[model samples]
Target chain A: MKKITLLTLSFTLSLSLILLTTGCAPDAKSHTGGAESLDSGLPSENIDATSILGAESGIAQAARPDGINPETDVDYSILSTETVYFNYDSFSIRSSERAKLEKIAKWLTDNSGKRLMVSGHTDTRGTLEYNRGLGERRALAIREYLVGLGIAQDRIFTISYGEERPADTGDNENAHSLNRRAMPGVITK
Target chain B: MRSQYDLNSMTKKLYTVLFAASLGALLSSSLFAIEVEVSGTKKIAVQISAFQGADAALAQKIVTEDLRRTLMIDPVVSQGSYSVAASVSGGSLNGKLTDTARGSEVFSRTYSGELRKMAHEFSDDILESLTQVKGFSTSRVAFISGTQGAKELYTMDIDGANIKRLTSDKSISANPSWSADGSSIAYMSYRSGYPDVYVIKLAQGIRTRVAGFPGINSGPVFSPDGQQLALTLSKDGNPEIYTISTSGGSPTRLTRTRGTETSPSWSPDGKQIIFNSDERGSNQLFTIASAGGEPIRITTPGTYSAEPCWSPDGSKIAYSTRTGGGFCVWVYDIATRVAKQVSPGLAEDPSWTCNSRHLVYSNNGSLYLLDTVTKQSARLDNGLTNCTEPAISR
Candidate 1:
């Protein structure tokens, strides 16, 4: 319990540090006066520091184009799952995804006798047919990890929604990164 | 935001050697008079003439060289059955212009006195050979040529004579792709500030806008049956291939993508279309079912390729590839996936005749007729006639 709390605190701190360093980066470099800074690496914050917002704010941008509604923000808990993803115009997962797959296998190990559906999603880009293929590859990658953990491929049905159901709708890259990630769902017994 | 480019490259060289007819009409246009010859028969022997003045021998040599170059551009010699350019010492101009319309008219340039004289004789023999199947001797090339930096569509004989303007507009008019029957020509013009497809009848001078989208509506190819026309349009916010009924109506989208698609070439049967696309991270040739489905790629390598025209027999496909710092014309054999390089210089925008034997294209400042079977070629006219797109009719 203590370890989880500590990790959560550090994750928040890292994000805040990232925002502070990036947000203030442009102002810090104003030494070259009167020039508009062109650095695109800056982080944009939606609400105040003390305010908490929805865990999944990616797709909410369609309704709240102005950004997160801090006062009305509802926090839906997000249970982290380390599902792997594929590369652009490719279906094969890379070596970098091995770590994520191991973590996912451990999750299935801890929660034994549980049913799960490995749903996959791709970011909105490329052709519809191509993206669908991409989603299937992503799902298959996750399924392959579970199968390596001795889980039957048939036991875990996979579904691919190629960029059709994006977790985020904001045009910004931060939202897109959050949406590119894959999450897990434990089916009821 | 979308664009497509395709290239057809032959892995192995085929038909590496070719030659043109040997006759006085073998060349056309210029001083030594080699460039003035056109439309040769089985073999037209071009005679190198000594200049009236200095360096008579050198001038004769110069004319011979230019004669070969001119023969390289003549459609009849460049693309037809077979022709060879061999210089001769002497010959008389016996060809006469029987077609009265050949008088200084754009179409008459195809009937230049010297060219007509040669065309008349060879066309007779060629007509005899043509009658075996049907000769294209009298057939002319309708193309878009420019002068004073402004272009207008024109038609002339394969000899590059009797050039006449078809569309006299202040704006640019180009790519005069003729229909199979030789009765009408479809081309692109910017008279409306945006490129649009316009079809003009030969004898009646009836001009009709076949396609005009809000954006680019150009590169129209008449189906073999002439019932449908395939074209490229950017109306959907990006360039993509589309088709419409020839009689005129709404268009049917053939491709949906982020990549721009243009330069649509229909198959001889009109059941398929080979197009240029960058869908695979680079510009390459791709074919799609005429009704629209998955596209099968044909060309494997090359970053720049475009403007594909299907052979009349549907046995092969001709396209342009960026080579040697300029686009060179090549033909791809569909069944074997083999390509044969035809054009010796920068060439693009290939359009074929009903015979499917020769291809008309443009390089540098003039149009050229490239014979896939013969190595012969010919320059269209002078620099005043900046020919880019050449379409020949049966």
Candidate 2:
């Protein structure tokens, strides 16, 4: 318990020191004085400190306009096991993947107030734009299946990563099949 | 006998002089003549003399490289149809283009800006004066750089310099499409944990969410007029093409296809849109009137074709076709209706330069500039790995 407290205290001191150094350095702020800083129009407290530090380090990063970090706002890993896979160049949910969606639907029913965010993905074999559309279809297919399972349509949101975020970054068939998927995440309404 | 021989020799010498005079006149008349065909078969030779003053070598180098990449101008040391005389002094570049054949000045201008930008401007001016076609030297390409798995929107000069990250969303961003005037870029980002279309004004650094519909909101491409964006939205059930005003408003649906439709590219005149669809079981290119109408299949079915980009000149549509288990960039002649493969292996997302004779495509995570007519290509070295979805400003 004592060690945990000490570590927490050191981490807090380091974070504050970082903020002080970044706040004092005009050059660091000036480097990000372009579009990103002007776009958010949000206060510094609401902005993600790591993203600001990323900008200070010359990696230009944009803060969310609403000042919400989705990574921390919603935990996607809660429904990780319920993720469904798709066929090659296809968004049709295979018969084998039906149980996964049923599990997710049951979880959504149990949670009641929580919504679902289904992120669709594809293998890196086709054009990015086309894959994006395909990924959307995959997510929509899952949404339709979940809706059929009695989940409300408005309670689900969908996004497509196309081939951008691949589960497996390999060039073989196994990786391609593994990459094509629709992952369900639990999000607060 | 000697008198007769002398008369014949004088006649021969007179004829030779006459022939030389006519040839010289022809050469002078053809100097800087505009070639109607953009096949890049003939290149005008321009002599770029050694620049004078500070930063002379750097200025000359950049200008020469810009001209060379066009595949329209051949830079030589001497004996060129045209010549460029340049000098840099006190943060200013003065350049003069001369028609060597007629010994007349074409244009002279003074440019002040970043050294590389000034050089590009000078090169563009030279190209315009010679061919009457605008050069793409000053144009920028907005692309998605996926370095470290944090896909972000970034823009760079056509020559791959001055890279600026327009978004640090710390999330996936893709399909960057620039406004016709190059003032703004419309792209999709998952910043809010959902796909949303946003337009970022480059000068002001302001971003406005244009489309955040219930389902997937993606593939936002600016219309030629920069007023409307034709994008893919699944709000109406399936992925379909819809046009929305740049400002937030109700979107006008263009396609009612049950299959997926995305990547809508507008015609230069803003009268037509060519996009990709899989309504026939396989993805194919289709064209439709910008106004509500039926979509006409442009590519043959059975083969996979997607990511259709209409050239700025409205003469060709460049797209990626599945060939030999990999994607290759192919250009479909609008007039001839013949599709010819312009790239070799794994080339996709072909974006045309302003000249419409060159295309910038992504292959294996690197962007490449391709001269469609000459089949010459060069990899754009932006020093960033995993860069894709290049949208060159027309």
In candidate 1, what are the lDDT values of residues A1-189, reduced to their tens digit?
445688889999999998888753223222211113212122322112221112212111011112222112211122354655555434445678668667666766776765455555676443322333345445544555557667654455444444545677665656555555444555443
Summarize candidate 1's per-residue lDDT along B1-394 as a digit string, tens digits.
1222221122122222222222323443243453233343334332222233223343234333333333332223123233322122234222211212332211111222333344333333332332232334455777766642357888886655566778777666765666767777888776654457888877898998888654456677777777778887655443577888876689999876545466778887778998876544435577888987766666533444567788888988788876645577878777766666778766777776556666678776587766666545666563354566677776
- For model 2, what is the error of residue B309's alpha carbon versus the real structure, in angstroms, after optimal superposition? 1.5
Per residue, candidate 2 scores C-alpha lDDT tens digits across B271-372 of: 998888776666877887889777777743236888889899899888888876778888888776666778856698899999888889998889988888
* TM-score list, all predictions: 0.49, 0.77
- lDDT for B44 in candidate 2 is 86
What does the lDDT read for residue B357 in candidate 1?
66
TM-score of candidate 2 to 2 decimals? 0.77
Q: Tell me the alpha-carbon RMSD of every candidate.
A: 25.0, 22.5
Scored by lDDT, the top model is: 2
Give lDDT tens digits, candidate 2, residues A50-100: 212111233211112243334555567899998899877777777898899
Instruction: Tell me how candidate 2 scores on lDDT.
Output: 0.80
